[model samples]
Target chain A: MATTDKRDPRVVRTHNDVPAVALRLLLDEGWEAVTPVRVATEAGYSRATIYTHWPERIDLLRDAFAQFSEMPHHEASGDAELDLRGELASFSRAMVEHRLDRALATLAERTQTNPEIAPIRNTFVADGERPMRHTLRALAEDPAAEAALLMLTGMVTHSVLMHGTPPSDEVLDAAVDIVMRGLAQRD
Target chain B: MATTDKRDPRVVRTHNDVPAVALRLLLDEGWEAVTPVRVATEAGYSRATIYTHWPERIDLLRDAFAQFSEMPHHEASGDAELDLRGELASFSRAMVEHRLDRALATLAERTQTNPEIAPIRNTFVADGERPMRHTLRALAEDPAAEAALLMLTGMVTHSVLMHGTPPSDEVLDAAVDIVMRGLAQRD
Candidate 1:
C-alpha cells in the first residue's frame, strides 16, 4: 500500500523553511552573511540538512535569487511602447521592492574576482533579462532590441545605485518614453 | 647653503609608484584586495609612506579611482547630437580600456553596506556624470536631462557587464542616435 503521511514534518519543514530563511537572511544581512551554518541556526535546521540539499553556498544564494527573480509574467500587449513601459515599471518596482540593486552589486563585486561565481551570476542576469528581451524583439529586430534591452537594464541599475533608492514610477516612465522614442527613430 | 634637489628620487617614486600599484591591484584582484599594506608591499614603499599620502583606505581607493577617472576633455563639435555621440564613444572606450565596469561594480557593492565609503563613491559618480548632464541640459531641459543622463549611464554599464566587454563603436553610435532622436522628440 502506497501511504502518504502528511509528508514527514522534517522534510516539509526543510523544503519550506530553508529557502524562506535563506531569503530573509540575504535581504537582512547581504549575500556575504548568508552562510549554511547561519541559515541552519536561523531556520532551526541542522547544518547537515542544509548541506545535504545544497552542497554549495552558491546553490543557496542562487535559490534565494531565483525566488527573488520570480515576478508576474510581463505579456506584451502588441503596443511596443506601452509594453516597454510596463516592463520598465515592473523592473524598477522589483528592484526597489526586493533590494535587487544591492544583491546585484554584491554579486557583481564577487564575479570580478571569483570565476566560479560568474556563471551563476550570469544565469541570474540572463534569466531576469529573458522577458525584457522578448518584449524588445517584439518591438524591434535583433541587434537594436538587444541594445535597447541592455540600456533599459543599465538605466534601472544606475538609478538605484546612484540614488541608493529604487527609481520612482515617474522616472521609469520618462526613461521608457525616451528609449522608445529612440527606438522608433531607429526604425 | 640649503639646496633643493629637483625632487627626491624616493619621494617621487613613492608618489608615482603607490597609485600605479594600487590601481593594478584593484584591477587585477578586485577592490577588497587593494589595501594600504598590499599597496606598500607591491610598490616597495613603507606603510608609513603610503599612509602619509592617504590617511584612510577609502582615501587610497578614491585616489586610485580619481587617477582612473582622468579622461581627455571631450570637446563638443557645436552639434549637440554629434557631441553626445562623441561623449558616448569616449565613455564606452574608457569603460573598456580602464576596466571601469569591474571597479564601479565593486564600489557599488561597498557603498551599499559601508556608509563610510558611500560619499566617496557618490563623489566619483557625480564627477563622471557632470559632463553628460551638461550635454543633456544643452539638448533638453532639467528633468529630461537628468533622466537621459541616468539612462545613458545605465546603457553603457549594462553593455559592459553583460558582454564582459565595452560596447563597440557601432553599438555606442546606435545608442547615441536613439537617445538623440528621443531628445529631439521631447522638444
Candidate 2:
C-alpha cells in the first residue's frame, strides 16, 4: 500500500526519519556504506517500509542530499553590496556547516560514471547556484554576472577542497569585498 | 633483487609503462577498475612485476594520480596583469585537458579517512595551488592575494564540477580579466 497519507503522524515521521538516518550514515561512512537495508535497520524501520518510501538507494540519497542543499533565503536590503556580501557569507556558512562542499565533490565525481546520480547531483548544484546567480544578476549583467557567480562559488569550493575546511569569516568577507570591488570597477 | 637498476632499459621501460597503463584505465574505466591485476593484464606485464614497482594498490593509484595532476609552467612575461591572465588560462587548460579536476576531486574525498592517500592528495592540491598563489602574491598581498587565488581556482573548479568539462577559453579569459581588473582597482 502507498504510504503518502498526511493524516497519519507515524507515516510522516517515518518518511522524514529515513532520509535523516541515511544522511548520517553517508556523512559518517561515505556513500558505499549507505545501503537500503542498513538505513532501514538503523532508522528502526522495516526493509519493506523503506522500500515502499524510497524504492531505490539513489532516491534515498537524493532526499538526504536535498535536505542539506537548501539555500538560505535572502531579502535584499537597500544596499546591494552589503546584501550580496551577506548572501555570500550565508551561502559559505551553510555549505561549510552542512559539509555540502565535501559531499558535493564526492557526488560530482560519482556523476561522471553513474548516469543515475547525475540528475540528483545537478539538482544539488542548481539549488546552490540559484540564489547566488540571482544576486549577481541583480548587481551585474550578462557575462559579468556569470563571472562573478563562478568566482564566488569557486572561492568557497576551492577553500574547502584545499584545506579540508570551510573558509574563515575574515577570508569570506575579504573575498566578497574583492569581488564586489571588482564588479563595481567594471562600471 | 631491487628493481631500481639504472642500466637496464627493459626495467626502465616497464617502470615508466605501468603508471601510464594505470592512468589510461583510470580515465577509461574510472578508479575502481584500476586494480593491479587488471593493469598488468592490460599493460602486458605480470602482477608480480607491477607489484614490485608499486608494492601497494594505493601506491599504484598515487602514481597514476600524480601523472595526471602535473600543473603547467607559466613564465612571467613582465606584465603582471598579462602574466596572471596567462597563468590562469594555462591552469584552466591543464586541468581540463588532463582531467585533473575530476581525478583530484575523487582523491580528495578519499583522503578524509584514507590516511594512506592523504599525502598524495595534499601534493596534488599544493602543486595546483603553488603557481596561482605565486601569481596572486605578485599581484596583491595578504588576504586579497589569498582571496584572488581562491576565486580564480573556484571558477575553474566550479565549471568542471557543474559541466563535467573545463571552462571554455573565452570564459576563462573573461574570468581572468574580471578578477585582474578587480585586483587592479584595489590599489
Candidate 3:
C-alpha cells in the first residue's frame, strides 16, 4: 500500500519528475519549441498538476535553472587568492559548458523586466555572491577582499555571457591572470 | 542659400533632426513606445522621409546609441590610478543617470533572442568595446589592461541593468576604489 502522509512521497516524486522531463524536452528542442501543454503531455502529468506546481512558464524555467545553480561549489584550498581564482575559473567553465546556458541567460535578462522573475534572479545573484565573499575574506587581506571578490565574479561572468564561443583555455587562463594582477593587494 | 557646395546644409540638418527627435521620444516614453510613425510625427517629418533615412528601426536605434557613445571622452587627470578611477565613476554615473538606460537594456536583452536584432546588438557591443579597450590601455600597464577594461564596463552595465537603480555616488566611489586598487601597478 502507498503510505499516506501530509507531504506525500509520490508528490515529491511527481514534482521531481516534472522538471526532469520538461528539461529533456528543452534540451532536445529549444525554448520557443516548449509549451506548457506540451510539457505536461511529455511529462505524463495533467495540465492542472503542472500549473499547481508552476503557475507560469518563467516559473518552470526558473526551476530548471535551479537544477544547475546547485552545482558543487568549488572549495578554496587554503591560499585564498589562488582558491578564489581557481573557483572562478571553474564556475565560468561550468556555466559555459552547459548546453542550456544561452537559454538561461535569455531568461535571466528577461527577468529584469518581468516583475515575477526579478526577485528570483536577485536571490540567485545574492547566493552566488555570498560564498565568494566568504572565500575572499578567508584569503584576501581585509582591504582587498570585497573588491577582489567583485572583480573576479564580474570578469568570469561577463566572459562567459558575452563570448559566443566557449573561451579557449588559453583565453580563460589569461583572463584569470589579469584579474589576479588587478586585485593584487597594495600598500 | 544657407549652404550648397558639396553637402546640402538642409539635408544635414534633416539627417541630424531624425535621431534627436527619436532620442527624445525614447527617453520620455521608453523604447517600447517608439515607432517610425511616432518619430516622424514628432519630428515634423513625413513617415516616408523617416523610412528613407533609416530604412530600419535597428538603424535608428543604433545611431542613437552611437551618438551618445561618442560624447567627449574624458581625459583622466592626476595620478594614473586616480584618473582611471575618476573616469570610470564618471562613465558609470552617466550611464546610470540616463533615463533611457532601462529601455535600452530591455532592447539589448530582446536582441539576444530576436534574430533580426542580434547582429545589431553585437555590432554595438564591438563598437563600444573598442573605445573601452583604448581607454584601459592608456590607464593601466599592459598585461592586465584588457581585464581591467572588461571588468569596469561589465560591472557598471550589469549593476544598473540588473538592479534597475542608479548606484549611489558612494557605491560608485567604492566600486572605483576597489577596482583601481586591484589594477594599480605593484612595486
Candidate 4:
C-alpha cells in the first residue's frame, strides 16, 4: 500500500486525494457509483494509478470509508456530562456536514438485500462506538455503554436527518442530563 | 372513495387488500416499484379498477404509506416508567416484525433528493411522536418530549436495523432508567 516514493509530497497527495474522491461519491451516491475509474477521473489521477492502489470496488469503499468515518476526537473534560453533550453535539454537526444520515440510512437499506455490506457499516459504527463506549462505560457497566450510545445516536441522528437540522442546545442539554441522571441514580 | 358496494365483504377486502399489496412493494423495493399496475397485478384486481382509485404514482404511494404506517397501540398503565419501557420494548419488537427500520431508512434516503416525499416521513414521524409526546411531556415539559423520543428511536433503530436485532431487555431497562433519572433530577 506504500506509494512508490514515500518522501515525495506529490505521491502523498495522491494517496489521500483519490480516496477522498471515492468517499465523496460513496456518500453522495451509493456504493455502485464508486469505481476506480470514477475515482481517477474525479481526483485527476490516471485510471492506472487508481487501479494500482485500489484494485477492487471494496478496496475503494474501505479506503473511502476510512475517510468517511473520521470524527474529530473529543478530549474528555473529566465531566461526563460535558463530554457526552459535546460528543452528541459534534455528531449532529457532523451528520449535517457530511450528509451522514443519508450515508447511514443508505447503508441500512443496502444491508437488507446485500449482506456483505453489513460489515462495512458494522466497521463504520464500531470505529465510532468503540471510543465513546470507553468513556461511557463508567456510567454503569458494559451494557450501559451500548444502550447509552445508541440512545445518543438515535437522538442526534433522528433530529439531524429527519428534521434536516442539527438539534438545538436545549435538546442536547436535556439528553445529556438524562444520561448523566441515569448514571447518578446508579451511584 | 366509497366502494360501489360498501356493504359487500368482497368490496371491503379489495379496498384494504390493494393498498396492502402496494405497501408490501414499497417496503421491500422502495417507492419506484409501487404502482397501480403492480398493485392490480398483485391484488388480482383489474388495472382499470386500480386506476379508478389511484390514478397516479403519488396516489399509490400515499395510499400505500397509509397502510405501511400502521402501528399497534400501547395502553398506559398510569405508571410512566412502565409505560415508557413497554412502549420502547414493543417498538423494538414491532420493528423486527414489520422490518420497519428498512422502510424508515428508505424513506429517509428518498427524502434526500425528493422534497415531495418529505411529508411522507414527516407524517409518519408525527403520527408516532404525537401520542408519545403526551406521555413523555410529564417528564420535563415540551422539549424533553422531542429529545427523549429521538433518543429512544435511535436506541431501538440502531440496534434493530444496524445490528440486525432488537435491544435486549437489559439495555431497554437502562435506557428508560436514564431518561427517568434525567426527569427526576429536573424535578
User: In order, what lDDT does every prediction score?
Assistant: 0.76, 0.76, 0.61, 0.76
**Two-chain complex of model 3, DockQ on C-alpha atoms against the true structure:** 0.29
Expressed as tens digits, the lDDT of each residue in A1-187 for candidate 1 is 2266578777875776788788888878887779999998998888999999989998888787677665665677877778777777777777767777777777777777777777777887888888778878877775677667777777887777765665666667777777788888875
Kept native contacts, as fractions per model, are 0.62, 0.65, 0.20, 0.74
Q: List candidate 4 segments past 4 Å from native.
A: A1-12, B1-12
Locate the minimum summed-lDDT window of 10 residues in model 4 chain B: B1-10
What TM-score would you give candidate 3 relative to the actual structure?
0.77
Interface root-mean-square deviation, each candidate = 1.7, 1.7, 3.7, 1.6
TM-score of each: 0.85, 0.86, 0.77, 0.89
lDDT of model 4 at residue A95?
A: 77
Per residue, candidate 2 scores C-alpha lDDT tens digits across B47-89 of 9998888888888898887775444567777676677677777
Clash tally, candidates in order: 1, 1, 1, 1
Q: Who is ahead in TM-score, 2 or 4?
A: 4
lDDT, candidate 1, B1-187, per-residue tens? 1156577777766766787788888889877778999998988888998889889888788778777666664787778777777777777777767777777887788888788877777887888777778878888875667767877777777666644566666666676777788878975
Better of 2 and 4 by lDDT: 2
Judging by TM-score, tell me the better candidate of 3 and 4: 4
Candidate 3 lDDT over residue span B1-187, tens digit each: 4445567676687778888777767666656656888888988998998898889887777666555665444564545556555665665656656543444454454554566665655665565556556656775665466666656555655555545444455544555555555555433
lDDT of 2 by residue, A1-187 (tens): 3456646788788877988888888888888878999998999999999999899888899988877754455666757677767767776776667766667767877776687887887787778778778877887886777878888887777767655666677767777777777777775
For the record, the alpha-carbon RMSD of candidate 4 to the native fold, in angstroms, is 3.2
Off by over 4 Å in 2: A1-7, A70-78, B1-7, B69-76, B168-170
A125: Cα error in model 4, Å: 1.3
Candidate 4's displacement at residue B145, Å, is: 2.8
Fnat of candidate 3: 0.20
